[model samples]
Target: MTLHQLRIFWAVAHARSFTKASKVLGLAQPSLSQQISKLEDDVGTQLFNRNRNELELTDAGIFLSRKAELILSSVDETLVGLKEFAEGTRGVIAVGALSSIARILLPRAMHRLSAEFPEVEVDIHETAPAEALELLYGRRLTMAILATDSIASSSVSFHQTEVFSDPYVLAVPRGIDLAQVNDVEADLAEPDRAVVNSTIQFNFGSQHKRRIEAWYQKVLPHYRVIGQTRTYEVALSMVQEGLGVAVVPALTACVGADQSYDVTLYRTSLPDRRLVALTPSQYVRVEPFASCLRHLRETGDDIALPHIEPGPPLMKAL
Candidate 1:
């Protein structure tokens, strides 16, 4: 019934165990059990069915869990709003972003933000979209910048603003021409053409992964995946070493020094990866976060990608 009890129950439900939830909340297990018992006694209905080692939420527990999320979220927002009256634009804003994308965007954005508001501090977590979304939901991150395609469908609600859009490009070894070579088997020389047929693929589960696979199958019919990685840097590094080619976003190759990659990029017909900043609606209007988001948008707009060549007709067919 109490807000404290509701928070304990919510944490226990999500963690699925009082012991685990105790560790997460930095509270004693005995205290958590006592609180939950008090809450269940007050409600006059069993919320959780204690099964030997595992905890299962009852029908009522399931219902209350959903409501508890909303109530706690609203309460957090109220606190944030109240604190803003005293702090104004001086506070820490923890952000989660893809490592490759963050390198290109955050530098310029943080520079502008610092120049305007010296008291604002940005805590950046370079992570994949799935992990970023998790951190956002757990209240560990103030905002998350992610590619829409990379994130799985989720029930959690967030206010999203499109920050960057860049086309997927074919990363090949430098000096290997794909401009006029439609047929991979016949166009390029032996041992070298083999590299083009060998793909360094992205290893991840998402809607985007399927699309990338389908594109490869359609364009490079004879291609075989020789390497796989979850990070763009690894995939691009494999391509740079002449290990194999990869289909990656243009910005992935443009991170830091363009020459450091030592790979040539060719355009792809696949849809562009749309990057967006996801935040709770309440945080959108809060200071430091508001100015931080503005600078991110400005930096995204001013982005200039490295040189990319046009793919051959067959690669562009899709």
Candidate 2:
């Protein structure tokens, strides 16, 4: 079938509404219907089933949509590559990053890439750690920055360049009296304290709850934990609101002039987490992109840890 037909089919499958897909594709509803009908005729199967108000992809449609996405993505990449080749200088690089890295590392990296390799067009996609890994495997992303805790699939090779690492810090509300509190015990002792009251108001998940429990049981057996949250920002916001103390990665809770809230960062004995830059083994040999990565390892201070040493130099195989 024609590329146009595949495009129409894919859009319809994704939006699950013929009319909605028509609006997105900027085509008349009739024309969109005709395209899908023709594609289904050519494939000799129905692609979707229409319920009263919703559309569901049939088994065949689900399979075809996956392949269509790859085909379109490949075509787009090829066009970008050809354009870069014709320019005879820097190449196009597609980089993916987690939200945390996008906020802290990407802006600086983009500025440096533009200044040093003006001709190389850089496209940055911000997504979750798991999603970034999927895009990397699909060849949609040339490289990515993600948490070290995330598992890299077999299709991807880990370069292990540490981008940022920071130890967890205990953040308490600005006006809280910690003089009497030796550890978590003193903090937890005043369950009726404003901080503890605030902590009980917020929801704490299993992982964070475990951390709080461990802190009380091992680190400070007498201290009581009233609340916890997965989001670092949320915990910080709570601290600002006179809520209970929160334990968060130091990199995420750094305070500056822009911060209006009153909070203090206390060094904690918890284990630190590392953020790593991951690249396809094939692209590691590409000098321009590799150089940018090297610079980050050497100079990025978004995280509180020491500068990350570059891993074994990339061997050029191209």
Q: Considering every candidate listed, which one attains the maximal lDDT?
A: 1
- Model 2 Cα lDDT, one tens digit per residue, 1-318: 887787777667756677767765668989988888888899999988978786898999889977976676566545544654665665767778754466666666767767777777778887656556656544557778876655444423445567677776566676554434434433445543545334421133345457645653553333444555545666678777775666666655544323323566666666676777887554454557677787667546643431222211110110
Relative to the true structure, how large is the alpha-carbon lDDT of every model?
0.83, 0.61
RMSD of each candidate relative to the true structure: 3.4, 9.8
- Per-model TM-score versus the true fold: 0.85, 0.58
At residue 264, give the lDDT of candidate 1: 91
lDDT of 1 by residue, 247-298 (tens): 9999888766444478998889888889889987888887777888898999
Q: Output the lDDT of residue 1, model 1.
A: 90
Task: Enumerate residue pairs that collide in model 2.
Answer: 185-223
Kindly report which residue stretches of model 2 are placed more than 4 angstroms away from their true locations once superposed.
1-84, 88-92, 152-156, 177-180, 183-213, 216-230, 255-261, 301-318
